[model samples]
Target: MLVLFLIATTSSVGFAQIYDLGGMYTYHYRDGRYSDWGDFSLHGSRIAIDELNESGVLGGARIRMTNENTIDYHCWPENAALMAETLMKKGILVLTGAGCSGPAVDIARVAEKYKIPVISNGSNASMLSSAEEFPYFVRVVSPSEQYEGYLINVAAHFGVEEIAYFYTTDAWGLGARDVIHEYTQQRDINIAQEYSYPRDTPYDEIKSYMNKVKQAGIRHIVNTSPTPDTVMIFRALHELEMNEPGYSFYAAEMISADEAPEVVAGSLGYFAPMVELVPSPKLSQFRDALEKRLGKPVDPSSKAFFYGALSYDHMLAVGYAIRDIQDAGESVTSQNMMTYLRRMDFDGTTGHVSLVRGTNDRANMPIQIVNSHGYKDNGTTVDFVSVGRVDPATGELILNEDSIVWPGNVTTPPKQ
Candidate 1:
């Protein structure tokens, strides 16, 4: 049975006329591995709402997301569709949330059917790039396809002629797997073997899969799994003694620096739609405000922080669209909102946010390649450092080869 969890909204300014915005999120995963992402995202959205209303961005119109409207779908597709329809019935101008790909896809379908716009902070499945299929769907993050080229480049950088690929059997994982296959083929990089695992595969089964990869003598591996599953994969590799010199691991998702650091140390990975946050007074103020609201220090290097920043930008985009529509002496409707959203270009917390002209994905968002290495400032601490980046403007793959601490604490790429 599917259950909907409602999040209580923050205080809102009283207005005679209010614009309704709905949210569908995964506040609690079955194993509670991803709840922090949902919680932080909700806080970010609420903060944006409060600021937008207080700043009088919409003049007489204020945005309101009530507790009853924000539904937690638990990352289930069925629940997402159902919850989206429930909110649409209330005449929401735009639908927000959908922190994961499965729920994001479902919500997009529902929004398309109703001719309403849906903005996502976390969903990055490549299939969502189809404007024809999901005309009303847009995301603050780049699609999974954008990361594949960088992954292939990293493999080629290490002189890897072949790689073993592992991915989960889910929307995000499958989308990433397909794109990687296309990219590797284009680059003439051989895929030695492909392994697909269910999201809930047991530890022993993962270990067995690792053993098979070891038997195959594949030193270059690329994994496209969520962070939780990535942790288990690293554990299995550690147990098999395969996460050492001469064995390279690359991930499609970013893992927390504090999560099983001993196992994932020296692994290379990329997270999309992010650039180093430009230091500005506004950026600093936003960080301070967000940290105060979250009751914790915001680690710009952390994945959760990026998600939160994207969520904040998600609301800002919506607010800006509504403001533009009203400024044009037009009624704030779904169609008008969609119009302004597609042309959105602004400096957001996550950097400059803009949608591609035809596709639903963001444009000119850089992908950063990070190495899980010991922080040079504090040698005892393991953290992710920017070793390379895909230049957003030129699509150039830039690597600081001398700075990367490769697997087994080596300052050079391990030969395959």
Candidate 2:
């Protein structure tokens, strides 16, 4: 239900040429569950559009972006493909988003059929990394395989030889599970128990699963569930008295610190392949602009905020390709845009951005290992803080051990 039209002013000598860009965003679920991620992403793209227009990167050319809400059809593959086709009929040169993995897959299929480039900031299923499968698809975020190593490395760092693995039976979850299995084998870590739950499994069922985990005497656990489901798992663990000093949980997905911060306060942290916003003038300006757009204060620690950065990078990449094509005195066509994007490399807000030649996945992206806890300055205010990171180049796990606050405010890691 969100639609925006951006028009750039051109010089007096020439008429402004217009190009259409399409977006498929998730605003809410079929059951009336609301999410702010879509707004965050849309505003991020808006910023890039404003920058490109004001910078006069495209001369007399102006880009018009139209976004469609995937409401009532959130994460549905057929709906996404249909939406893409609808936008393509309008002569959109490029497409962006369908944030969830399921819909992202279908959007990519439409992109290939139409020969237009599609970029996403959220979808990270490993199967999408296949260039043969999705030629015109590219994403700013790294795939699940890129950061699943952090789970195994964190386990190894704590000298935990065995852990229970919990995942949902979906594309993202299954892909993460497979990658984690491979990494665990390489690290000689044993998965003492493996459990798969359907998406949207109730809290009571999750509690039952936790009971089995307790019975198996598994204190260390790795979870690859969605954020809401991860929160439910944390709640179940708390109810079962499993959120003790000796228990550890590492998540492949980023859990929202705003949701159930009390419940998720003490477990092991989650992995995020996002740019950690440091204090800089550029970051301050970006935050101010976004805050103004949202009519609210921005939470620097939230995953949605970081996803905004990725969205900005996505649009920036498209802008770069368009500029490059125009500078070469070539028509801005879909095939030409894809040609430029396939080998695009530039410093972006997130960091140094480069697309892998074949897979179109961002290469050597750093992974931040973060945990949610009470802020050091004010114990009452909880937030996510970086405690470690995985090196993009070497895939080495580095932990700031002293900075990590374990469950119950304990400074030392729990004993295995």
Each candidate: how many clashes? Answer: 0, 0
**TM-score against truth, every candidate:** 0.89, 0.89
Error of 1 at 276 (Å): 4.1
Name the TM-score of candidate 1: 0.89
lDDT for each candidate structure? 0.77, 0.74
lDDT of each residue in 75-167, candidate 2, tens digit only = 445566787888877778888766677678777888998998888877888988988899888888778887666767877888988988889
**129-167, model 1: which lDDT tens digit per residue?**
988988889998888877766878778877888988888
lDDT of 2: 0.74
lDDT of 1 at 281: 70
The true-versus-predicted C-alpha distance at residue 4 of model 2, in Å, is 35
